[model samples]
Target: MFIREITHWFARRSFQNRIFLLILFTSTIVMLAITWYLTDITKERLHYQVGQRALIQAMQISAMPELVEAVEAHDLPRIKALIDPMRSFSDATYITVGNEKGQRLYHVNPNEIGKYMEGGDSDDALYNAKSYVSVRKGSLGSSLRGKSPIQDSTGKVIGIVSVGYTLEQLESWLNLQISSLLFPMALLLLVLLYCARRFSLHIKKQMLNMEPQQLSQLLIQQSVLFESVFEGLIAIDSQHRITAINQTARRLLNLSQPESELIGYAIHHIVLPEAFFYDAPQKNKKDEIVTFNQMKVIASRMAVIIDNQPQGWVISFRNKDDINTLSLQLSQVRQYADNLRAVQHEHRNLISTIAGLLFLKRYDNALALIQQQSESHQKVLDFISHNFRDHHLAGLLIGKYYRAKELGLELIFDPSSFVEHLPSSLSHNEWISIVGNLLDNAYNTTLLNREGSRQIECLINSEGNEVIIEVADQGCGIDENIRQHIFERGVTTHNNGDHGIGLWLVHSYVKQANGDIIVDNNNPFGTIFTLYIPFTREE
Candidate 1:
């Protein structure tokens, strides 16, 4: 019952204890597995090395001239002194010699000393023997044997040099290796178990001290609550000094950080392009402090509505880029709607002309006119069906296509280079921005150019798994003064209503697709915009 109670207490501990336990189990399992494998490899290597040493010792001792002479002389003392050190072998224990009568001259121990070495082909055999080279041992053991003999000057075998050792040495060495391997691993297991327990305890303490609800609340407040429930803020005071700031106010004025050399500096001095600040609001109503273009924005100020006016003038003026984007999107929608109205108007006019021709008794001519209209209309409808139908980015591309046409510029989609089942990583928005912005820029440049040909070419080709797109135009190639700044946001050569937004959008889309874009004036070939898009998202 006491053990059960302790188990229940452990189960009731915080979630982090469970995580730490999991880490401990997995890490220890992996570490011990690797340790065991390394131990086995070490043991095998040790046994191999010891076995080789025993074999070489046997060969070297047998090859000695004195040991050979002792065998030939049948001298027991000399033979015993030569090889008496290695007598513990359970399987192979034999030293042999061969004389001219095929009788043993001598051996190490008296049990086998002076025994005949038998069952070999010729008496000259032992003279030709080599070290660690095995031959059939016919005297005592069936094991492999090494033989080296003493020889006279006439190449006659004086006697045999014989030594025998079994694989029992390899077995004994393996046992010793196992002992050496197991001891260190057993000690490591003890230390590692203690480490796992201590690690779990430390992790449990840190988890017990944590409060997740409070941390989540902090992130929530930073993202959501801080924007609304605070000060009525204005970045500049009545005299245009950098008097007050909030999160939104600081963002509005583009304040620098770290060593803010421009702090307490005039707001107008730091804002981009000196022209924007002249029309900035002064002292106005509490709600209508700063006018970003025509949109009224309440500036950030101190928290109060006192003296029938703000206690202090705080304003939130925004950059003009937002205003321009909002306006352009609105214009695109409105202008596209207008173009549809015009298409409907043309259809009505065509119907009316055919009806009036029939009434004026020009039936044949009316029929011919109807056939011509049908062919032309069918061609356009077929083009739309073939090029855009079922395409993932069709709706997106069509919007920009119509917008380009509405601007008195042509968007020429190449007839021969249409693709189907496009790469899945290229999102709908990305395709739209890539195709739309490039086409829009080319159209704008073509309109601006006074050249003979006014054309904007949009080509898309899929090669293997990659997509290559090029947008070009016969516009007077980008002027040198602004060529370096063409793709940068808010930098423009001519800014009427098209406020330098397209090329930056193009740059962003290419980067998002894991791609690159090269902008080059085509010398005598116009402006060529190339985009290389990869087929996959590695991350």
Candidate 2:
């Protein structure tokens, strides 16, 4: 339970604090262990050195000829006189001279003279003439003593010499050594703690000061957002190596390799055109058309910046075909709105005319006008509905008829025109773009000639192996110089910027369906557009 509490406490701290505490704890443990080991070693060495010094001093006193002769003659005064000066000059706490009978003849204390050695440890030195060091309690109480035997001319042991250092004195010396060592050890520990703190702070800064859990959650959210975008996205490092690529990018690029295999590959190794990589790093480029894997795309390049520093680039793109489809759909909606407005205006005019005839009491004329208007609208609706099976195509023609009437031009469908169904070779929208753009072009062109027939003719036939559409308008003919490039983007007879895309889209869709288009000069004046598309049965 205590350990669990400690773990919880540690876990509650901030990341930087936790790192600091862990480092400090580990370093402190290591330093303490080293200090303890050194202290033990120092203590043992100090004791060994002290004992050796005492032994050497005892040996020197025992070897003195005058001390040995005095002990042999059993002369207490001579022994005391010979040892006093030596004892006063030495570091040993006490020195004593003892006869062969284990009775002290000379001592640092006068009372200790003539007394038997209190430690009873002089047997070996007095009888066997051995010199050694020992820890024993004597008149001076617990001391480390070195004893040496005195020998006469015959080599017989005559007396003993003892040199002693008290435990108190040894302890004082050890304390002095330890105090010197401790100061540096404490300084080293403080330095280690300071370094650990700096290291922890550095680590925290690198992590952006966020916890690990927060970073993990952020990563998960970013991954979801990165993959959820509709546009294809790719990120590359400064070295032009792929760092990240979304699934949409892989699909758009027609790459079958897994994302894991694509990462770290050089960006140039992918199927992007050279233009995407050139002048890409120095500045951002947007909405530039470039071919990727042989497919044209509207792409944008942006530099990835962090902390006001350039890291790499992020490129986003979408297929141009997708953009064209969206544009076509929006155009169709606008056309529908325009047709509704025209129908409303035409009805309002008819209503006002009928009301005026009623006010004048001309009932027969009002009835005739109503019948004529109904028949005209019903005839065109019936023709479109009965001939074109696809509702979208029928509706498009009906809307175009109303739009043409509003523009003061006649929109006539060829009597021989019949369309059962569009083939599966092209989407309905593509077919719509082709047929709608042609009729719209005819409408615009015929309106240019105020003195002409002001009529546009359309023919759609799908009864054979191919689908054929022809639109002829009695308007100014196409210019000889620009007829060749009329299908190219940004080529238009009108001065408006928006006038060029319709024909280009029509040409693009036709080519994508593997179809052919022919432009011809109509008789007298105007232009004719004919499209032939091969039909394939839907599986």
lDDT at residue 52 of model 1 (Cα atoms): 52
Q: Give the per-residue lDDT digits (tens) of candidate 2, residues 322-402.
A: 986887679678878987988988898999999999999999999999999999999999999999998878888988998
The RMSD (Cα, Å) of candidate 1 is 28.3
Which numbered prediction scores highest in lDDT against the true structure? 2
Q: Give the range where candidate 2 is weakest over 10 consecutive residues by summed lDDT.
A: 271-280
Give stretches of model 2 more than 4 Å off: 118-128, 231-245, 250-539
lDDT of each: 0.59, 0.87
Q: Which stretches of candidate 1 lie over 4 Å from their true place?
A: 1-342, 345-366, 387-392, 396-410, 422-426, 522-525, 537-539
Point out the worst 10-residue segment of candidate 1 by lDDT: 280-289
Error of 1 at 333 (Å): 4.3
Q: Model 2 Cα displacement at 289 (Å)?
A: 5.4
Assess the local accuracy of residue 240 in candidate 1 as a C-alpha lDDT between 0 and 100.
Answer: 58
